[model samples]
Target: MTIVFISDDAQALACGADAVAAAFEKAGCTVERVSSWGMFWLEPLVEIGGLGYGPVRVEDVEGILTRHAELVSASTPHPSSSATIEAWTLERQSPTVKQVQGDDLCVGSLEHHPFIARQQRHSFARAGKTRPLSLVDYTATGGWTGLDRARSMAPADVVAEVTASGLRGRGGAGFPAGIKWKTVLEAKGTTKYIVCNADEGDSATFADRMMMEGDPFHLLEGMAIAAHAVGAGEGYVYVRSEYPHAIAKLNAAIALAAEKLAPFRVEVRVGAGAYVCGEETSLLNSIEGKRAEVRAKPPLPALEGLFGCPTVVNNVLTLAAIPHIMAEGGASRYAELGMGRSKGTMPIQLAGNIKHGGLFETAFGITLNELIHDIGGGTASGRPVKAVQVGGPLGAYIHPDQFDLPFDYEAYSVADALIGHGGITVFDDSADMGAMARFAFEFCAAESCGKCTPCRIGSTRGVELIDRILGSGKTAPDSVEALPQMHNARKAGRSRDEEFQLLEDLCETMQFGSLCALGGFTPYPVRSALKHWPEDFGQAGSAQ
Candidate 1:
């Protein structure tokens, strides 16, 4: 009998899965360590093939192994297929066991479980099913077949398929992926590069971490396909240093895949934790061992990037989707799945104060209401659902009335919001929109690379101004107010309406004058909050 136990996943490790794996091996059974299923509440999971029994400890391993041995003592190649063990059988457990199950050998099949089955997984198809760094295991589960097929087609054809599929960058901007590829392919540079932006610093977002840890080979194949199409000889995956497990898995996957796929080598680079580095130009600067600051456009990364050469910079999920696009023989299979220009599936992260929080991938047309009410099961607090920040901290705090908004890029942009990185952070009714908006300014202030004055200075001023507005009990006046008579508004003091107008001016400066999305997008959340949750931001005539 073989016992499978979780080896990676920080939460699983903390739950003492290593001890359980050790116990199973000591009891004279073959044990394999696999990546986590990523479900937090039910972890330290032990599996007899796909049949799972979890939240178990070191002490429970021996009994489970004993039960498995009793159920199928013979050398069965697959423990899950053993008729003696049986499936779909339910039974009650003793009071001392603290749970109920058919046997210690069987809990239930994870394949049909709601947590796994509820998702329309495509890019995340083999998340918990395959080994994180094993090339052989990755291939057995339909991994590199797309690269094998991409190897035969012309570079233009691959770009054509991506363009036709309506695939866009999942790293927030929602720019067309095929268009970017075409630009890079046509750009004049012999030393072009392929870069994967894995510097994910957004709150409530861990899809990139999950992909790198659970399905590394998928990301590798995606990068390799990009390299082949662009005629690039080198690639870099700039992972965040905070993700030690992801970095280790990516390095291992790179070492193995480099051997089979020669001429195209991928190197893993770690960044100093800076949110601005998630931007492409800043990421390039970090790779060059320079200060991580946003760069000016007009020389898009496609035309002149790393080392001043043409480059293709893509998000982890965007590149991860390449294998699927190529395997399905062009974008037709994936293109039909989404709505309007926002084609194909997006891996939405259901997080923050929400029930059943995890990754849910689906087409772009799904309403936020479905994600919040149905998939998320509303707030974890059991209170009425309030606002939802669809992108990240920079995204708007969408009220419940606007819950019908679709998860499309254009749709969100039209609503004064953004679907940046596809990270959905839910908030319950108790949440204060004013506080959330203020945090956006504070985050921008702390994370600004300081290269652009609008982002660096304006963000700090915005935070200070919001504090005054909230403290002074202000609201927008009937007309724009004049600037404060003197500096240090706290001492000199302006009218509530004047301070409110000052905030609007600061937001405008950040939005129009900033060099990158870090500054340009900060106003989205700020303005949205002031517009929708006026009552929460302290009101006019309410002198505190």
Candidate 2:
């Protein structure tokens, strides 16, 4: 009399729900749709009588019914309680979830895991552990307590508390979150907005998606708190289209939260698969139904943002952390957990060629070496770890020698890198640094909004220069002559020069003149490669 449908795609499930319910009625059972249990290979999995049946193709319904009838009469190997099945379903896909469930020893309980448990998590504590859409579950775990507290306090006091937390924007800029909120609060606009930039385009990072999928209410709670503090009644979460799961969960959570916390409505805006939209200004443009492009920053997003109103734009994690800051104590308490100027726990994303590819939340003192070897457990391919790219696409490529470097902004900056979004992408010995460096420029070129000439043209020139240096044609003599010319060309002031020099000049222009981090910091990875991986650049134009 009970039927359950599971799908990796929510829209697919929603679309098929009625058809499935009709089939269930024909068979005298009620049907319900649920999110995938993470075993994507067997999608549209159907459960009846405590047994899972799938890769459940639409044409295989009759087969499933026959199989179920047989299973009813015979003993099934996969028999388990519904609760256990649901628990297994949820835990199977995420290592972070498995860690929370004690399936992985190194990660331990998600709440007590060293990576996630050691530091304060006011916003993320209940994310993976709670029912994302249930208001009762959210409230039971101290959800709206921060909003209630903020409602009682003066807006200035809320801003002061955020400032005290020393929480910086998690959207790669490292700007102070409280300062941003204060700017919106003090701006002379009758209407203000709280924008949650969930357009996480970085392939190596999944913190926002995971947070949205596992604990959507925390993000909503954080946004609600921001609205209360900044006097903004309306908020929007601009999420990337690639994360359909995250979008669906966020939408459902918003609806549930709207019903639960009436009068405060949070809407979600979907992005059109543009990586540049991750940039705040570009995101604002996209939200306004314009082309996703970067804008000049003199006005700053705080002073003039979405719809030309004063707005507070923050990363999903940054806003999610606000509730914890309010609920637990103050900014100083959260700030005390990390090292140096980096005053909070960072949810580090371990991905790309690594054995342990998952989210690791820890204080900002852990070394890159520890992250890759001790925590990540080295390359999945059993190859020697060659290079590590920290932050996101715009972050620098760091060598093993720099692995001892701490995980803080200033520390990374001193090393010509930035801990952007705390993403750590590992590359084994087979990875080509020269190629990666070229890809960095290529990526910039592709994602650049064309608002600045430096990023638009420089990225194109960088790829060509790298190809000229590494391409397999020139001889030793060409190599010897090309090196000094390339170096001098870099030093020269003219934009028209050797391709390498032109690329360098482009980097400088972008760094100094570009509107936002997207164009400004594309040079970080490119320059870092030129500095650290000279061998990959080869002896100028020497043949491979």
Question: Each model's C-alpha lDDT?
Answer: 0.80, 0.72
Can you write out model 2's per-residue Cα lDDT over 1-544, one digit (the tens) per residue? 3444343234335445345545655665545444333222233445554345544555556666665555444443332234433443443333433322221111122233344343345445553334556666667767788878887899999999999888999988789898899999999988889999999988688788778876788888889889888888789999999888888889988877785444567899999988999999899999999988788776898999999999899999999888878874756678787887788888888888887566677778889888889877899899998888898889998989999999988988888899988888899999877788889888988988887777788788777767665664222334444576565433322222354565677678878877778778888888777777767776344221
List clash counts for every candidate, in order: 0, 4
Identify the candidate with maximal lDDT.
1
Relative to the true structure, candidate 1 reaches a TM of 0.87
Q: Which ten residues in a row have the lowest lDDT in candidate 1?
A: 88-97
Residue ranges of candidate 1 with Cα displaced over 4 Å: 5-7, 14-16, 23-29, 57-107, 328-330, 472-491, 540-544
lDDT of 1 by residue, 1-544 (tens): 4546455665566788778777777876666556666565556777664556777877787776666555434332234433221231221111212222345445555665666767778898875555577666677778888898888999998888888888999999989999999999999878999999999999988889889988888998889899988889999999998899889888887787787667898899998889889999999999999999788897899998998999999999999999999996547889888888899999998889888677788888899888888877888899988788878878888889998988888898888888998888888989898898899999999999999899999998888788877784343322234345534234436787787778888889999999999998899889888887777778643322
What candidate 2 gets wrong by more than 4 Å, as runs, is 1-122, 328-332, 472-500, 540-544
For TM-score, the strongest prediction is 1
Structural similarity to truth (TM-score) of each candidate: 0.87, 0.77
RMSD of each: 5.9, 7.8
